[model samples]
Target: MIPIDFKGKRLVLFGAGRVARLMFSRFPELNVVAFADNDSAKHGTFVGKVPVVQPEALRHLEYDLVVISTGWWESITAQLQALGVAPSRIVLPPKNMLAINNGEKPFSHAPTKALALEVLGCVADFSARHAIPIMLDFGTLLGAVRDGDLIPWDDDIDFSLNDHAYPLFVNHLADLKVALPKPAGCDLDMTVLEAEDLITGVAVTYRNAVGCNAIVPFEIGFMRRVIENGQSVTKGAGPSFIAPEVHFHNVGSITFLGKQFCTPDDALGYLSYVYGDWKTPRQDVTLAEYPMQESEYLETSRTLV
Candidate 1:
């Protein structure tokens, strides 16, 4: 079920692509006032009976929330922010659109889980062979420790690499790509490595060779140990808080999917810091809604990867 309360609320879907059409068909009760697209070609088009207009049209539309209905939601989020849309008024897509249930524990997308595990196994093997430290992070860690499997609603896998291992991983990207097993009519793509002040990460995707649909893409975040105010802290390239360095150090291993995977030394403590109540199942909550700790580093640095 969608986390948002759509009753009597107006909405603007920020794309006219396949996902937008799916949302329209699945939730006909939504009062979508317009479809906003960046593509000029779609400016005068129609998604079903809803008019597709320029993103600028959002200024004239009276809506309660803007639903980003495309895979490129990150960029669209920035666009919405530039247009002065409040963060609380933006709704991201659910973990798995097609598999969403009425707030129950939905089944994991079979193909997605299979493909993600395969990729994770290959990456883990490569990391072991090269002696580069990488640990299951974020939702992946939560799933591994709490459920002994991937979170049913999670769409991707996550791992974290320290400063030392990040350089090695980047240097051996080509070899890693070659080592990963590919699905039928698909090739592994490990070329995309992103590094920004706010976040540093790598994405592993599948490049379809034929008409094969793309599989799941996993992320690897780069975490750094920095000194602030005479104390050591751990900070990721993403929204992760500047946490005490002790929790992340001396990495340990745990069984995930029946295989040993690296994790934070004090995994439970780390989870507590990031998720106030890590044991409960709550699919409707977003990262922004998680409990926050005061960080002297950045005013907004209280969430997780």
Candidate 2:
């Protein structure tokens, strides 16, 4: 488990659900501001006098640590990420605790496939209705889904829009009923373009860039910008197609740890580049192997999936 130093940092809590109450009782020394949740029913209520406020009210507040104390963990994480939370700020109890708990309500410790599919559906529906185009992305276990049927251990979905369309996403969201979860770096979410490097995988899913972990909510609106430039176009002839491919530049190699890793980046990079950048399509690359694929080429790869 990763240990976080809380010696002299501002911390906040969200959701006054059972988990929030339990955590507060156990770690009273932590500087907790109050609770933030989507349930309107919980508004005006207080958890031990820490007010249960709506998410919007705390958007401008700053915090070094934000604890997610909710059961719909994956969905909450998605909302938070959209708002601009950093991935390292979120967590749940270890797998041991998760395995043993069997209460009236199922405990969600991390993002699950069930959650991934739901998020995918939600984003897809929203984008389509608003005429927003998206590139359906699959990564990791999601990649396996594309390669075969292997179930990945984690959960996430990917959809990416180039630099131009992000602002429109923010304007659209500003008028919605959606409620974002406040987590770490919530106030800094507006700085996503500057705070972190935008990493892309030549052969992985879009969500893979922002996988499991804690993040904050952003109202500055990169997503809206993405939606604005996305458009729908028809495919081949006789029938009508509404999905136009979103525009993206082919990034040659990704620099990590001060080193540039080329695609056919992995052996898969070879296949993806061939099928994509090089314009020479290869039917499933996972189907066959240069056999020692894992040990030969991938053995020394240092990038963390």
Candidate 3:
């Protein structure tokens, strides 16, 4: 066990990569003061929508804890020490927790599939209680039905509700508490964006930006199309699995994060329509567009018969 706990500490994360982004989802209690990276290109960048600064910039800011969010945690710790950051102020995720995924060259926390699923469930509970209908949207939806988990490099959770139900959430949902369980299997919590609006729909970010802990992500969307889909796509009270991709499964459940949540009628087909190459992970890169791949049902049928 890494003896995880971040109470009464204001943190400054070094390296604005996947690890830094995931720190939030894994340890929501952590009070991150700011983010610092050595990359000159990322100096003026933002991780988790938080600004990134150079080492020298640390002198002007205030923080109590420093975490090295990179595979080179060892060297970064020493560098921070040389820069006068106290050893006690520095923290490192357990060595056992550091892991690599696919062809990615970063050492982040092992994938926590459960943590992501639990948060999804919590939102479902919230929606049901408030009578607000919400469905997984965009990358989050694609990853769930396709890979059965969040996309590695993709940071954030996404959801789209029917335009009519949008007001139900807006009028209700005092807040979004990310459902993070205790035990090492997974950790989840909740954090609604400050000052949520109505029309924009609330953007909920559940993925913590790494492998297990999740990617730095924001969950936002709603049904009803705008000119993107050939000007014919307009928002409406949809039955789902109609426009994006045909979800033959019909609205039902799929196991994710150790629990079952409702998915499109044809969750698998919907994924195929959006992301053609759904099996292989895309970590910090893009691939040339290709034809739509077969959905889970089609692939499974081939295996069965």
For this target, which candidate reaches the highest TM-score against the unseen true structure? Answer: 1
Candidate 3 local Cα displacement, residue 193, angstroms: 9.6
lDDT of 2 by residue, 233-254 (tens): 2111111112222323332233
Tens digit per residue, CA lDDT, model 3, 118-229: 5667777776566555667556777776676676545445666544555666555445432223434222333332211224334333334334544322333334322233
User: Model 1 lDDT vs. the true structure?
Assistant: 0.65
Cα-based RMSD of the predictions, in order?
7.9, 19.4, 15.5
lDDT of 1 by residue, 168-204 (tens): 7667767786777767865554434333443345555
List of clashing residue pairs for candidate 1: 198-237, 199-237
Largest lDDT belongs to which candidate?
1
- TM-score of decoy 1: 0.63
Model 2 regions more than 4 Å off: 1-3, 93-305
Q: Which run of 10 residues does model 2 get worst, by summed lDDT?
A: 290-299
TM-scores of the models, in the given order? Answer: 0.63, 0.30, 0.41
Better structure of 2 and 3 per TM-score: 3
